[model samples]
Target: MLRTVSVLVDARDRAEALVRGHEERLEAVAGQSRRRPRPRVYTEEWDEPLITGMRWMSVLVRIACSDDVFPEPARQPAAKYRIVTPEAVLACRPEVILAS
Candidate 1:
């Protein structure tokens, strides 16, 4: 029981550290942009972990935004997901055929 508690604590600490590091990087980038005279156009995406349950499951929080002056061009769209199969891989590389 004590071991399980220790593990949970460790996992929580690690998650917190990762979140802190990401936040620091974001701040650094923002600070650099502030120093520049011209407006910068770029998208920044980050995943925030939301720990839940006794086992410490993380839920991803994806956020994407751009700092562009033009509203029309400032739109930063979310990434699209695609499903790839073994057949597709084999088509590209006939030498390495995968067995079902």
Candidate 2:
């Protein structure tokens, strides 16, 4: 099954230019970077009187993309959701914030 899926995915890549489209563009923009540093990022759900952040799979997305994603020591594989104090965020000093 794994071999079959790999073959199918490879065929799809040849037939479909849109496969990994965004990744291709981002790579182009990245320009064969050698010493380029990944930007630190923070993803949050809201910012009312309190601040909270995404954990586990959500945070994993940024890490996979090679971004210096923040809110370390996530309560992952345990609490899918968690809190992020302003102090902690400030300490991370993220270059980008994805608040949604």
Residue 31 Cα positional deviation in candidate 2, in Å, after optimal superposition: 3.0
Q: Which parts of model 2 have CA positions greater than 4 angstroms off?
A: 1-15, 32-37, 48-80
Compared with the true structure, all predictions reach lDDT values of 0.33, 0.56
User: Tens digits of per-residue lDDT for model 2 on 24-99?
Assistant: 8656655644356666767665576334454643544444453534445343433334465788778878787777
Candidate 1 lDDT (Cα, 0 to 1)? 0.33
lDDT of 1 by residue, 1-100 (tens): 4445657777766666677798888677766655555422212122122111110111111112222212232232322222234343334332211111
RMSD each, Å: 15.2, 5.8
Off by over 4 Å in 1: 1-10, 40-66, 69-100
Query: What TM-score number comes out for model 1?
Result: 0.33
User: Which stretch of 10 consecutive residues in model 2 shows the poorest summed lDDT?
Assistant: 73-82
87: Cα error in model 2, Å: 1.2
Number of the predicted model whose TM-score against the real structure is largest: 2
